[model samples]
Every structure is written in C-alpha cells, then in structure tokens.
Target chain A: MNRVNGDAVLGAAIVVASVLAVLVWVPRDTGSAIVEVVRGSMRIGDALAPTIGFSLLGIAGLILMIEARATGSTLRLDRFDLVFIAGVGGIFLCAMLLMRWSGPLAAALFSDESYRNLRGTLPWKYVGFIIGGGFMIGTLISLVDRRLTARVYLLGFVVALCLALVYDLPFGSLLLPPNGDV
Target chain B: MDYVLLGIQSVFSNTAMFSVFGVGIPSCLVTLFLGLLTGIAVGATPGLAGPTAMAVSLPILISVFGVRPDALLPVFGFLIGVMKGATVGGAVPAILFNVPGTPDAIMTTLDGHPMAKRGMPRRALRIAHFSSVTGDTASDIVLFVCAPFLAIMVERFLDLPEKTALIILSLTFISSVMGSSVGKGLIAVALGVLAATVATGQTFHPRLTLGIDGLQNGFPMVSAVLGALILGEIFVTLNDIWRGERQASTVQSSHGDVADGLQKGDLRRIMPHIARSSVIGTLIGALPGVGSTLAATLGYTVGRGIHKRRKRPEDPDFGEGAPEGIAATEAANSAVSGANLIPVLSLGIPGNAAAVFLILAADSIGGFNPGPAVFNFTRPQINPELVVAFGIFTLMALGNLLNWTIGGAFMRAMSVMSRIPIRLLLPIVLMVTLTAIYIQDTRMAALWITFGFGILGFFFRRLDIPVLPFVIAFILAGTLENTARQAFSATGGDPFFLFRSATSVIFLLMAVAIIVFLGRRKGHGAAATHPN
Candidate 1:
C-alpha cells in the first residue's frame, strides 16, 4: 500500500513539477531561453513563444495522464522477468560493441582484409535462417531435446558452409563501371 | 581588450545573431522535405553516417571552389546544414530498410520498422521521422543552454583521476542500463580495452604492426572506425542473408490518414521522456568520446526506469512505439552532437568518433591544442573563429528546430523500399558491404575483420552483451591510458600520483560507490535470467 501510495505521490509530484515549471519558471525566462522564437523566426520576437509554448503543451499531457490515473492506468511493465533482461542485454550489447574496438581480438581470430569485408554482408537470408531455424528447431524437438540439439548443430554448420560457398565464392571476373552509369 | 570585443562582434554582429537565425532555415527545408517526400533514398546504405555526408563533401569546397579562410565559415555552415538534413534523411531508410542511416536511426527501427511491415510505411516513416526531428531540434536548444552552462563547472574541475573515474561511472551506467547484463558489458569493455592495446607499443617502436607498414603508424582512424563499426554491421547483414531461406521481397501497402498521423494525444504522452532525454543528452554530450550512443542509452534508460516508477497512466508503452521511446532517442542522440564538443573546446579530448576526426583536421592547421589553454588563448583571440563557432551553434540550433517540425515527412517517402523482397534486401546488404570496405583501400583484409566481428557481434548479441560501453571504452582506452602515463611521468613515474589529487580522490570514491551499487544488483538474481 505504501509503495503504491509512494508511486502515486511521485506521479503527482512529477505532474506538479511540470506544471510549476511551465507556469512560473518558463515565463520568467521565456524571452531569454533558447527555445523561444523557433517557429516563424522568419522575423524577430517570434521565436521564443513557440518553444516554451510547445514545452508547456507537452507538460500538459503528462498532467492529464496523472489525473486520469485516479481511475486505473499505470505505465505498462513486464514483471521482473523482463525488466531484468535489460541487464543481460547490456552484457551481449557491450561484447559486440567492444569487439569493434578490439583490434587484437580481430587479428587473433581472422585476416584483416576479410574481416573488414564482412560488415556489409548481413542479408535477409541470414535473418531468415536464424528466425526459420529457430522456429524449425524449436518446433521439431523443443530445441533442448538431445537429438534436436545435434541436428541444429549440424544444420548450422552446413548452412554456414553453403553461405561461404554461395555468396563469398570469389570470381576474378571484373568489369568497370559503365561510363553512362558512372 | 578590443580583440575580445571584436571576436564577440564577429559572432553576433551579423545583424543581431541573424547569421545564427539563418542556420535554422535548413531545418525548415529538411522538415519540409520530410513532409513532401515522406522519405529519402540511399541514406540507409551501410557505412554512411549522418556526419559522413559533410565529411566527404568538405574537401569539395576547398578544391573545387578555392575557398579561403573567410569561406570556411560558410562552408562549415553548409556542412552543419547538411548534418541537419542527414539526421532527418537517416530516418527514411531506417523505417524502410530496417538498416539505420545513423546510430540515432536505431531507435526508429523499433516501431518504425514494424509500421513499415504493416504497409503503413509512409505513415510510420513520416510520423517517426517527424517525431525524431522535432525531438532532435528540441534537444539542440537544450544543449545551447546546458553545455555552456556546464562548461563553467567542467572547466573548473581539476582532477584527472576524477575525470577518469567519471568515465568509469558512465561505463558502469551503460552496462547497467543496457538490455543485457553488467557482466557482459564488463566483458565487452575488457575486450575493447584489449583491442585498443594493439599496435601501441611503449615509444619508439609500434607493437603488433606485424610487418605491415600501414599498421606501423597504427590503424588509420577512418579505416579502423570503418572497419570495426561499419564493416561489422555489414557482415552481420550478409551473415543473416546467407542463413535465411526467405528469398522474396516483401510487398507492403500504404496506410494513410490524417487522424493516423501523430495526434496531439501522441505528442502529449511523449513529452516527459522527451524532456528527460533532452536533458540527459545535453549533459552527457558535453563530455567527450561519450557520444550519441551513450546519450541514446541514457535517454532510453531514463524511459526504461520510468516504467519501473510509472507516474503517468500511459507508461506501459514506454519501450514500444511509445512516444517516450521516440522522444528520448531523438532528443538524446541529436543533443549529444552539441554536448560532445564541450570537451573538445574546454579540454582537448574529442568526445566521440566524429569529433575525433574533426580534431585531427583542426590539429593539422597548428590550431591550439584542445585543452584549457585553448579556451584562454585560442578562443577569444580568434575573431573569425569565434564567429564560426557561434554561427555554427546558433545556426545548428535553428536547423534542428526546423528539423523537428517537418523533416520527418521527408523520411516517409522511403516506404517504397518495402516493395523489395526481403531476400534481395539481405543479399544487397552483403554486396554493399563488399563494395564499401573495398573502397576504403581495396583491402581484402577488412572483409575478414567484418566477418569476424559480425560473428563475434552475433554471439555477443545472442548472449546479450552491452555493445556501447565496450565501444566507448575502446575509443577512450588509449587516451585514458596515455593520460595516466603522462601524469605518471609528470610525477616521476610514481603510480600513487594518480591518487594524489583531491579531485582524483573524489572521482575514485564516486566510481567505487557507483560500481558497488550497480555491482550488488548483479550479485542478486536480479539479472541472472537475462545473463547477457
């Protein structure tokens, strides 16, 4: 109950703060702040009004939501199961981000030229495979079934090989850009 | 004394900041274009960042037009103008192609892509592009106030370790706020730091050059950035294309209605997060190397946390197409472009990747080094330069404001891309990947790096790693490490010198405290299930 009340109070406070800032503080510096004169700045004295006006307009929306909450609307949330996912996301996200900066990791793993070439290659086919394979493997054996895991492993390897052969299969044939196109 | 006044005049004497007023004119053009076309073509091509459009064209002004120093103002003014154009243009492809034009386009993908698939690509593209530009322009003004105001304080901050520690705190913040786990964020950072160590030897000799002459001077910044970040994105696209079975292009229908367009109700709901995102972007962007990505995440996270502490009845949509998501992302990403300069002007540190490139250019001209001395000596002394900065900032603000009101409409035109089969899209991404990297130097080695990072990135994404902190750490590690080394030499290699400053002490404590707090959350099962 206290938590609920606290949440409500905070919501009210946000709304109140928005209101106060818009009503009192905004007008005092209306002329001085940067946002003024954005709209119709084709002329002088026309800029500041729109900037502050829109800001307050935005604030008004928040206030309405707060008042409506006396009925029963709250920001949607997934239980703890989902919110915490953001944490794990941070990990994998960071890993990929760091990998770009990791010249050592790249050099250790692959040739520099080939590595540079790979960035542009993500196609729908790959997305299809991941999504399709996930669905197929997921459906065929619940993904965790012992037999399914081996099949998925085999399937992935085979697909990877085919991809290497098909798209990355090199051709010495060269043609210059046609002058008309160029 | 007269010099200062003259410099100030150069900046503002253009008919009472009218030059600044002229800058916003581009935004009006961009926003209007967004409205008219409802989309832009070719911006979604991989490796083209919002700033790249300007970077590539910068030389044309010099070589073709024979621009003098006086012409630099109008030239950069045009580039800044182009940046505003690109920010809105970037959204078109992001909505249509799922591939983003800039990192800021990443947010547009969440709902915009979905809307495109539903055949309302036009509406989604227009609305999102509109919302994005609006939010972007709004934040630019926020930075106009916030960065200079913060500079007054950041300029006074004298502790090296504290600055380092603050960066650590920011890294920690990135990890915690990522959709994955802190462990992953940390692992990524470690990996990034390790990556930065390559080819950097003690002094006379470059390490890990490994017999490559080009590498002896270290990876060229363009190649490295292009290779790791850009190519990596492309390779992943190719990998996806290869793995998939969907070979046909998708045919999407158009969904349009005035009521379906963003209603006042939509804008009303998104305001708070918009405000919050603007503030966070302004604050973080003022620091160097912590660019739009961190600002983006910070804004995104504030929205995420808002869900946890929901006050507004409309909070549930926070992550989805909720205006807050769009608002936060647009505001934060755009604002950071301005904020990232604070460090460049106040300190010599380049705040983000684009700034680093600019710094290299500025340095070649015997410009004052980017530190306190620059402010005192280099700043007020240059009459025209001050004019340039002021014109740039004020004009950029105008450009952004104009972007907000109408630029998104231009992006909506890209809905035609949905007509392409998904299969073709995937393979095209691959082909484009090959062509782009090859153009960097016809080096095949970059391809393999792209492939490797793609797989690595895939694995990291699969495992839920926070990519941003790792990227940031990678960018900053060399500088941070070098700074620490210099400070050490300044104190005769005493390791304790890092700890000697009271400012350092305070930053260290703050870093420790933040890590402990965030770390404890890790210790609990709070993040166990997600385990990125």
Candidate 2:
C-alpha cells in the first residue's frame, strides 16, 4: 500500500470511530444531560465539541493523504506489516491480560487465608509474572535471531524471579497483577 | 545575598539525609553516587536513554525514600547525577560500535569510531570523557549563577497573563521547531492538550472520557509518559528486530601504548573546541524546546569552521579521526545536561524530555514545585525550596567530579555492555516499567492507560510526528488553563484580557513570529528537496 492508501484507510477508521463515539459510546441523558459550557451564567450545549474536533482531525488526515499522493512519495506497507502488527499487538494484549486477570482468578481458587496471605504465605500472583515475563522474553529471543528453545523460557523465568525478589524483598513495592490484599 | 548564603548552607546540611529500615543513609551524596553509576550503565547501552533510566527508577526511588520535604535533595541528587553521567556514557558505545547510545551521541560516531578503528579506543574514550566533564562542569556553573537570579526576576515582574502568554510562546516554539512539519507538531500538541483535559478540574467532572468509568480519574502521569516514550520505543525496536532492519555493527577493540592517554599536544588542540562548544551548548540549553541533538550538530559545525581556518599540514583531516571532532560533539551534548535545567528551575518550563521527567518527579514527590514561587524570599524568612534547588546544584557538581575521575575507566567496560542483545534487554525494560507504574499508583487502570498510550506513541513514531510537543503540551496544559482563567477573571471577564499586559502581548507576538518564521523555513527546505 502506498502512503495515500494507508492514510486514507486511517482517516476513514478515525471518522468511523468518532461517529461511533458520539452515537453509541458517549453516554447521553435522555432529557437534560446535555453538557453546558458556562462561565458566569450564560451557557450552551458543548456535547458536540469532541465530535467536531474528531471530524476536523479526520479531514486533516485526509488532506495529508491527498498531499502525499500529489507529491508521489510512496510510504509503502505490505501484508507482512499487517501480520507483524497483529502478532506484536497480540503479544502485548496477552501480557496485559495475564498481568491483570490471572492474579484475581488464582486467588479465588485458594482459601481465604491463603488469598489474604498471598504475599507472605503463598506466591500465587507471581503466576502473572511468570506468564507475562515468559511471553515477553520468548518474543524478544525470537526477535533476536528467530530462535526459540526451552533455554529461552528458563532464562526468562530466572530473570522474572530476580526482578520479583529485588522489588518485593528489599523495596516492598507493588508486584505485577498486584496482591489482592492491597 | 541572604538567600545565597541560606542556599549554600542547605547544600551542606545533614537534614538532606534519609533513613532506610532504621539506618540513617546520607541520601544526597550516596544517592548521587549510585545514580551516576546507574547512568553510566544505562547510557552505555545502545537502546536506553537518560530519561528512560530516570523514568523507570523514579517511582521506585520515591517509594524507597518516602515523599517528604526532607527527601527532596536525595531524589534531585540522583536525577541530576543521571543527567550528567549519561552524557559522558553515551560516547562509549558511539566510539566502540559506531552506534550511538543516545540520540545526541550520533555526531560523536563520525570521528570516535574511526579513532577506535585505528587502535586508539582508549585515547578516543579519554578525549570524550575529559571534554564531557569539562563542558558539564562549565554548564553547571552557568546554571548555578543564572537560575537563581532568573527565578527572582520572574517572581518580581511576571503576572498571571504574562505567565500564561509565556507558556503559549513556549508551546509554539516547541511545536514549530520540532518534527518535520509545523502542522503535524501543532496537531500533536492539540491532541495532547485534549488528552489532558479528560477527568481534570476541581469540580470532579470528567470530559473526553466517552463515559468510561476508568478514565473518570484521568490518566496517571507516570504511566502515560512511560508508555509513550519508553514502551513505545520498545515496540518500535521490536518491529525493527522482527523485520531484520538493524544490522550488527562493531569495531575491533585493540590495545596500544598510544591509547594510554591524550598527549599534551592533543589536549592543546582540542581544548579550544571544547570551550567554544560549551558556550554554544549553554546558550542553546537555556532556551526552550531546542534539545541536545541540535546543540551537538551546531557545535560540530562550528568546530569544523574554526578548524578549517586554523588547519596545519600535519593535522588530521576533520572527518578522518580528529580529537577535535570528539571534543566538539561531547562538550556540546554534555553541556546541555546541566543547562537544560535552567528553564525548568527558573521558569517552570522544561527544555526537553529529560527535564520533563525531572518536573514529573518533583510533582509526584511533592514539597518542591519548579516555578519562580519556589524562590520567594521575604524580609526575615527564607525560601526552603530555593535551598533544596541549591543542594541539587551542589550534587550536579559532585556528579561532574565523578565523571572526571571514574568515567574513563568505566568507559572501557562499556565495550562488553554494548555486546548485550536488544532482545534480552528490552523485555527487562518492559517489566521494570510495568512494575514502576503499578507500584506508584497501585491501580490496574494506570497500566491500561500506559498500554493505550504506548500504541498511540508507536503510531506517532511511524507517522514521523514529534512526541516532544505532545508531551510538553500535556504537562503544561493544566497550568496554562488555570493561568488563563485567572487572568480572565482578574480582568472582569473581558475576552481580550490576554492582551492587557504588555509582557503578555509581547509573548503572544513572539509566538506568532516564531511560527511564521519556522513555517517559511520548512517550506524552503521542502522546495529545495523537491524542486520541479
């Protein structure tokens, strides 16, 4: 894809997102929740401010795309770029989910005392650490040389453990996925 | 004069110390030393920058020391040390592998690499170290002398309207001068200000949240910054690695007798370049928006001009492997580290991304705000914050001393450091960044904001838009809005109150003139590049 096409696609997506935001996303009061921009007493509904702003942004993006086409500068993207974006985004999403959701679920599976003493008695929340850290490390190792092995996962685990000890033991800082006790 | 004496006393006071687990630690000096060591390690890594190290460490450091007024000097000391040490450390990888550890070190690679290739790696490293320390020390002296006076002046003269206009002028300067086009820069700033408007104000009402519950409290400053600047860069690096865009580049490290130290003649030839570049860098650093990269480029250009006029038959060519080249680049970039703080301390406007991080730390930790009010001194009472600022200045001097003594020996170890693969290092960075934000806020919402901003930042990088303007806009928006409101209310709700103050009018005019001038300059450059 050329710069023009890519920019056009982006502009269209932004426009669609803005329309959706104004219609479905933004909560509106059925009767009198219209946002009022007031200084002293005089006021006007400003609920359309964001909609207008985003529409302007979409127009600006379209202009940029048109200018790029006129200049004949091809900012190329291939199918590989889409694949790369999806894979990287997928990894990031997985890491976020693991860091956020795994600890709570793990704690729920354990007894109340165990859940309360997650930091002192048991180390269940560190499951998020192992999973998130391992995923990041695996992707990183593969990135280095397109190579993946058990050694990479082991190295990732060790690295995660060392980080956990540094922050948890000496600093007593917040852990990833957070101990639900906090 | 009384303020000066008080500041000096505060710099040496034992009250600056903090306790850890009931053991009293001399926070100022010890933290400064540790920060300098960490900075050297961080700067020697090709993928990390000074601000990245500071951003990752700040929340943890705050948690360790606790956010008390007494802890101010210790935190400031560590940050100043990192800022100074990183400048010197960046030249290590630039010399060893022809890959700059930081953006400003790019110019150092031209001559520093060639010198290393010719088996005088130690000599190149020594020149870089001496020049960096010399320039840093010089700039710190300038900062110590100027920042106090400037702060006092601003406090006495500037009113709310003037301050508001000054921020506007700074935003315009930053947006117009950075990035490829003024349009893109302005767009970035607008978006940033819009982002900042969400979930803000004392009334507790949230706008621009699209009714999302998590966003009603606004984005966490640390996570937003870490996501956009640090994690965003990590994503970009991962993309490059996956695409095999970065090739492995290295130079053979060799030992020779000539590498032991610089000869007297070598020092004599390069000292002029260092001096000239230091002055240039200090001047540029005191300005808003322009950063060390520009200073380094300007210093290199000026050094080339001077050398050409005074060339001798026996002297090395400028690009081949001149110690003068290394001196010029290192002095300019290192000088920027200290001088960059001048605006932040005096005017409360950060000069660049690293200084922005410093301001962020001060805000999060509390007790010190970086504006002219911090310098307020009455008849009998003295400003305690001014004393803390001076203590930070004192720590900067100590950081320079460390660079002068231990820096060269440390540079040799950077060769081994540069060998670390980016793949292994970046994930560790990600984990640390995640932990820092989580520890500071203890909220999962902050992590989501970070990830979202990280994606936004990645797209900004891909699209060739400048992130600095956006960051500056986001950081300054609250102050700007508050000042504007105050100014308007003071004028009895006059819509044209911004022009009532002469200083405000002048500042607004300057903003307009700067935008027009930069737009024309960009137009000329574009036309020259693509002339029909």
Candidate 3:
C-alpha cells in the first residue's frame, strides 16, 4: 500500500472544491457573461475574472497534490484543532447573538419605547456592548485560565465599558455595536 | 518642484490644528507622536506586531476624522509613525527577555541576550537604537530620492496593457517568493482573487455573491483584511494556547548592574557592519514579497564573516555578546521599514502587510491613488495626489526624526509589556478588533464576513499557505481587472491585449518564466528528498 501525506489530502480537497466552484458555483451565482458587448464595444464581463481565478486555483491544487505526493510532506490537523475551532467559533456566535439581542431585550424589559428609539441614548447604547463584549472577554479568559472567577468577569466588564467610552466620548456620531444595528 | 514645495507646505500648514498649553499644534504631528508611543508598546509586547496595531487603529482613525482630504495626512502620519517606532521597539524584547517580539528580531536575540547577561544590556540597546535609526534614515533617503523617479519612468513608459502585465508579474513574484511552496502561494493568490470577485464593482452585474444582500455591495475592505491578517492570527494563537502547543517563557535573566553605555570606540567598531547591513536590507526590501527576516539573516551572516577575519584577541566573538552582531541585525531589519515603501509609493503594489495597511488607508480615504499616474509631472496644474505623496514622505521623515530623538527612551520603557501573557492579551485584541470593525461598518453582516475570512485565514496558516500573497492579490484584483478591461477595449477587442506591447509581452513572459523555473526547482528538490 502506498502512503499519502496530509498535504496530498489537503490538495486533493482543494482541487475538488475548486472544480465545484468553477463548474457549479460560478455558473449558478454569476449573472453576467464572460464577454459582453455594451454600446457596441466588447468588454470583459463580471464572470471572467472569477472564472479565471477558479480555473487557476484548480490547476494549482492539482500541481500541489502531485508535488505533495512526490515530497511526502505532512500537514498536521489533529482533533484538538477541530475542537478549539468549534469552541472558539461557538463563543463568537454566542457573543454576537448576545450583542444583537441585549439592547432589544433591555428596551423591552425596562423601557416603554423600542430599542430603535433608545439606541441613541446613553445608558441604552452601552447595554448590549457591555454585556456581550464583557462576556466574550471574560469567557475567553476563563477558557485560558482554566477557572472562572468574579474578578475576571469584573475586569471584562470594565474593559468593555472603557472601550465603549473610548469610542463614544469624543465621537458623537459613532454608534457602538448593537446600537448601530438597532 | 512646485509639488514638492506644496507637499511640504501641506504637512506644516495651519489646517487641522489642536490647542496644547495655549499654543496651537498640528494635529497630524500629535497623532504621529501618539502612534509612535502606541507602536512601541505594541512592538515590545511579545506576540503583537505592527500590522495588528495598524489594522485595529485604521477604522478608528477614519471614523474620528471622517474621509475628507484633510484626514489623509493625520491618518498616514499615525500609520507611518507606528511603522517606524515598531521597527525600533522590536529589538527591546530580544535584548531584555531573549524573546523576539517580531519575526525579524529572531537574529537580534542571538547576540543581544548574551550582551544583557554580560552586564552590557544598555550598551547593546544603544547599539541597536543607533544602528536602527541610522539604517532607517538611510533607507528613507533612498525612498525619497528613488520613488518619484521610478514613478516618473513607469508613468512615461507603461500603458494600460503594460501596467496590467506588471501587476500580473508582481502577483506571480509575490506568490513564488512568499510561502514554503510556490503552488501553495499560487493557490492563496487565486483564492484572494476569487474572494475579491464577490464585490460588485467594475462590472455591470454583481458576480459570485450567492444572492446575499450584504455581499451584494461587497465585504467591507477593512473588515476582510483585518479579519484575514489579524483575527486569523488571534484564532491560531488562541488555539495553540488552548491545546498546550504554546507556553510562556519562565526563565528570567537578571539584568547585571554594570557601566553598559555605548562607548565612542564601540560605535566605530560596529559602524562598518551597520553600513553593510543597511545596504543589504534596503536592496532586499525593495523587492516585492521579500521581507526583513531574510535581510537580517544575510546581514548577520555577512557581518559574522567580516568580524571573524578582523577579530581581535580581546574582542568577543559573533553571537557571544558582540555589539557588531546586534548592530547588523537591528540595522538590517530596521532598514526594511523605509525601503519596503518603494513598491507601495511608486507602483501602488504593497510588498508586505504594513504596506497593505497603508494602501488600504489610501483606498478607504479616496483622495489619493498610488500608481504611476500619481507622479504625472507633465500637467501644469498642481497634482494633489503628488502633493499627498510628498506629504506622506514628509510624515515619514518626521517619524524618523522622532525615532532618532525619543524612540530609544520610549522603547526601553515598553519592556514591561513583554511580561503580559499572550493568552490574555490576544482575546482582548480580538474584542477590540471586532469592535473597531463594527463601528466603521455599522453592520452585523460585516462582522460575519470578517469571521468567515478569519476562519479562511486560519486554514491558510495551518495549511502552510502564505497570507501576504492572498492579501496582495485580493487588493490588486480590482485594479488588474480594471486595467485588463481597459486594455482589451482599447485594443479593439483583441483577446491578446496583454501581449500587445513589447514591454507587456516581456512582463508576461517573465511572470510565466518565474512560475515555471521556481516551481520546477522546488519539484526537483522535493523529488530528491523523497526518492521512491
């Protein structure tokens, strides 16, 4: 049996993806022709650049696979990498969701008006960012420290608050996080 | 001559003044100082880099001073200040903690740590500072003299087809030189081009956006770039920390108390090394995609050879508390900062990540376009872009002046930053970066796109694919497509428009030759290693 290294596996995956992008995705997504005549002058279309890029990508992938097969160079992607990515990604998604929702939730629970009306106000604008940003920082720190402490959470909130003030103090026009969305 | 005067005048003009101690100071100068201070702190931090600081600060700078023409100088001044200060500050950690703050500082650790242990830390630091400032000033002088002339030549000679071909050559060169393998680099460039195609500019129809409304307008340039370069790095660092792949250095080297100031005789001894290394660094930096690490290695090797031949019985050997070694490495790496701007200011091509941020700033601000046309002196009218270019040069000069005067003191003060844990700092950086991006874009979709690109960047790093090629290619894709389209139309629908001119044909042929020659050489080496 012949042994295949991780570079070969990665290259083969890239080749497959590139082929799909060129044949399936590009045609389906791009609405314009590769060459179009506009006002009686021939011009390169929207699709040509991407088509060329994907084709080159495919060729490069093939070359990479061939070279990797010859070289037997290994690329390490262990289970730990997957878990770390997933964990970090989960934290990011949760933080974003909290950032998106905290302001609206605050307005619904505390204020008579919608988040849209209260977004430009002082305390209301600071709510979502402090909650979400603080949570992200604190949780990440805890993840690193292997233990969650109240001091970490407090530090996170303080840092988030400081960041908010830093942006909000001088710049009247600038909106912080969920406030802009609201 | 008029434009030069105008540019100098623009930088010093009373526009955008801030009051300090009942006296008016130029805001740009103030921002430049602040940026220098921030850069020193960032550089002294072990895992932080200049590009990361620039990436996080750019959107904030833009938001603070809108995108007006007046904002260009202040913004550029800050970025340039950071670039200059970071170069000087990177040696601090290498000297004090035996940890290189930046990649180029890897060479500095060889002799610097030894000098510190020998109770000459201050002397080693002085040598590094003097060498760094001198090399930086020398390279800045080269940039000042050479960039305009190169731009003039490119303007006079290269047409659209030739320009297109030049960009193609640059992309090919960057891909070939950057990563472990040319094929991987090419893949990175191709992916960058593909990512750039999602933007709805330069064509009648939106292309490759997958019917997403947020992507219809395109991924925010700042967000995508910051995500790929900065956030991606953070992700990888965090993962390493999580998986116990990275560990903090617990060994503490005591700073011995001794008279460690650089004596006048020491300066004379290291001067030749500094001079030679600065020249080597300047030449290497001018090439696209080649960076300071190579310059540092070459400088150290050459300096060691020269030192060996001229060795005195009393003098310390190279890499063993040798002041000349510190001078050579610091000078070489620091020199790259100024000469790296040659491609950026003249050809509108960024050779490295720092140059990429500068290009991004100019692109976002929209008053200046960097290219051959920037130096079109034929026009009787005052060229604003030319003046802005000179303003940038003036800012760089001012940055060097600051570095010469106060950069050493500031850098030494920032050594405390190295003690901060990377695991703690990176997450905070991630938050700050996300916030900065959010404030500029004011859209959730932009953050999502940034995260997605950050993931892609992580994969690129993990797979040993170079990110600089991808970034340079992404930035250049629009320009290349626009130039190609114009050339194709101008040549009466000729499909072979890239080969229409001799210069362009040569450029195209060079691009192909580089790929073929380098790729085959790499293949032969691989085949030799793995004989079946």
Number of the top candidate by TM-score? 3
Q: Worst lDDT window (10 residues) for model 3 chain A?
A: A1-10
RMSD of each: 18.8, 3.9, 2.0
What lDDT score belongs to each candidate, Candidate 1 first?
0.46, 0.75, 0.86
Local accuracy of candidate 2 as per-residue lDDT tens digits, B1-532: 7766665565556453566797665667777888887888888888888888998889878887788887777777788778877888899989877889889999999989888878788888899999989998999999998888898898889888889888889888887888765555665666666567576643444666656899878787787778888888887777777787874333334434454557678899999999999999999988877889999999999999898889897877677779999999999988887888888899998878778888888888898889888777766776687777777776787788887888778766766767777777887788788777877877767777887888778777776667888888788877777786677566666667779888889999998898668766765675466443
lDDT of each residue in A100-131, candidate 2, tens digit only:
55665677776565444564434775766666
Candidate 1: list runs displaced more than 4 Å. Answer: A1-182, B1-130, B149-152, B159-179, B209-214, B245-251, B254-374, B377-380, B383-388, B401-409, B417-471, B522-528
The sequence of per-residue lDDT tens digits that candidate 3 reaches over residues B1-532 is: 7888888888888365677687768778888998898888888888899998998899899997789988899899889988988888889889988988888999999999999988888888889899998999989999999999999999889999999999999999999878767789899999988888885545545788777777788777787788899988998888777777776432354686676688779989999999999999999999889989999999999999999999898999988989999999999998888999999889999998989999999988888988877887756777889999888888888898999899988887887888888877888899899999888888888888898889888888887888999999999999999998999898988898887689999998999999888887877886786665
Query: TM-scores of all models?
Result: 0.55, 0.90, 0.96
> DockQ for all models, in order?
0.02, 0.27, 0.62
lDDT, candidate 1, A1-182, per-residue tens: 23223324434554566456456654442233322223534111211222333343344234323323332222222233232233323422333233233332343465544423433343311332233222322222211132344544454335433532343334212211110011
Tens-digit lDDT track for model 1 on B57-122?
A: 333333322334444333444445555565556665556566666666687666566655655555
Question: Poorest 10 consecutive residues of model 1 chain B by lDDT?
Answer: B30-39
lDDT of 1: 0.46
Across A1-182, the per-residue lDDT of candidate 3 in tens digits comes to 13346777777888899888878888777767788888998988777898899988887888788778677654545677777778778888998899899999989999999999989887999899999998999888777777789887888889999999999998889988977777
Clash pairs, model 2 backbone = none
Sorted by DockQ, highest first, which candidate order results?
3, 2, 1
Give the chain B TM-score for each candidate. Answer: 0.67, 0.95, 0.96
